[model samples]
Target: MTQSTANFKVGNEKLIKVLDGASSHLRGLLEKQGRPDGALRIAVIGGGCSGLQYKMDLVDGPRDRDILVPSNAVNVVIDPKSALFVSGSELDYSDDLQQGGFKVTNPNAVVTCSCGESFSA
Candidate 1:
């Protein structure tokens, strides 16, 4: 690959941002699961009203070709295709009872469902 191409890919490696709240929450979750070395896996899935949704899980680490992003001392793993949809997105955490959980603020989403968990990019 050309130098510019390689530089571009490296630039996009940190496309997703994890907020302070998300980092803290995720770190707690990892500790609770007894996985200090674990990482959070974020993936886009089908079935939401907007045609896409996020499915997250805690895994041991990144698999082959998985993009690993370290932000706020937390490790996040995302696949290549999902990276496209979630580029420039920020991950945050909420502790409210009504809307409590990890949330994504994605700039690429053109439309979103009422549940706030699904979107069309």
Candidate 2:
């Protein structure tokens, strides 16, 4: 993985708290899922019901174009391609069963679904 000089900051208190919680959950899931060296990867991809969708997973390796951010003892990797769509966005986790799990709040999203899973930028 090529580390760029781009010192991206994972700001926002609520976002950080959410990321920390998500990191804890992800770490446990990864351990249970069985990959000691893996990390939680988040990306924006095309072709959802909307124009774009958020994609996340536990990945063991980083590609050349991935932008890396560290949060709560975990490495958060965002692909360079996806960064264009997700830049200036905040990641948050909701414990509410009705809207549980991680959620991405993108300032760049021109349109977003009620569930906040899909968007049009």
Candidate 3:
């Protein structure tokens, strides 16, 4: 894990809650990818059907000015800007044949796309 030189506090496990399913899946993915020490990065990006979408990636660790949250024994990192959109959100996973993937339930979102891949806050 890369250490940030900044001194500001970034620990906020409550920012986005990671459900059991999501945590388990993320841990497995990190292990398979040979990055058990890595963290999951969640960001809000524009250009989705609803004007906003979520982008996730497995990263080595939190960067400078990044918020590092620990939930369900998993580490999740978010940039300062992306934190605004994902605050008070919940991340979950599903193994259903049709909707099998990670999903974020954001309380700030007022409208979500029918595909469940985008939202408007």
Candidate 4:
């Protein structure tokens, strides 16, 4: 297995928190896709209304520069570069009437779009 150079902690908590709703949603998706062993990979990439966007996916395993963070019962993986942008973020799920999906609460973000889908640090 490839090793990671990224640090996985921020103050008293892990870099990110995969809340129960998000973890359950991820587990269900993985089960349906027959990839129960898969992990949720969260990365920040260029391009969005606010300049930076969050890209998430269910990955089979960790890459060479991935920081593995265990949250709830889910494994949250972050690339080294993305890790810096989301160091003190929380991965959560929302089931509201209008907007419902996985949301990233990132403390490192200096400015975020109105929809909360993108941000700039």
lDDT assessment of candidate 4: 0.83
lDDT of 2 by residue, 32-93 (tens): 87886676678788867778999898887466656666666666777767777877776767
Residue 88 in model 3: lDDT: 92
By lDDT, highest first, what's the ranking? Answer: 3, 1, 4, 2
TM value for model 3:
0.90
Residue-wise lDDT of candidate 4 within 13-111, one digit each (tens)? 358888889989988988898989888888899989999999988887677757888778878888878888998888888888777888999998999
**Best candidate (score: lDDT):** 3
- For candidate 1, list the clashing residue pairs, or say none: none
TM-score of each: 0.87, 0.74, 0.90, 0.85
lDDT of 3 at 25: 99
CA deviation > 4 Å runs, candidate 3: 1-9
Which predicted model would earn the best TM-score?
3
Candidate 1 per-residue C-alpha lDDT over 44-114 given as tens digits, one digit per residue, 9 for 90 to 100: 99879999999999998877667888877888888888988998999999998987899988999999987
Candidates arranged by TM-score, highest first: 3, 1, 4, 2
User: For each candidate, what is the lDDT?
Assistant: 0.84, 0.72, 0.88, 0.83
- lDDT, residue 90, candidate 2: 65
Model 1 error, position 67 (Å): 0.2
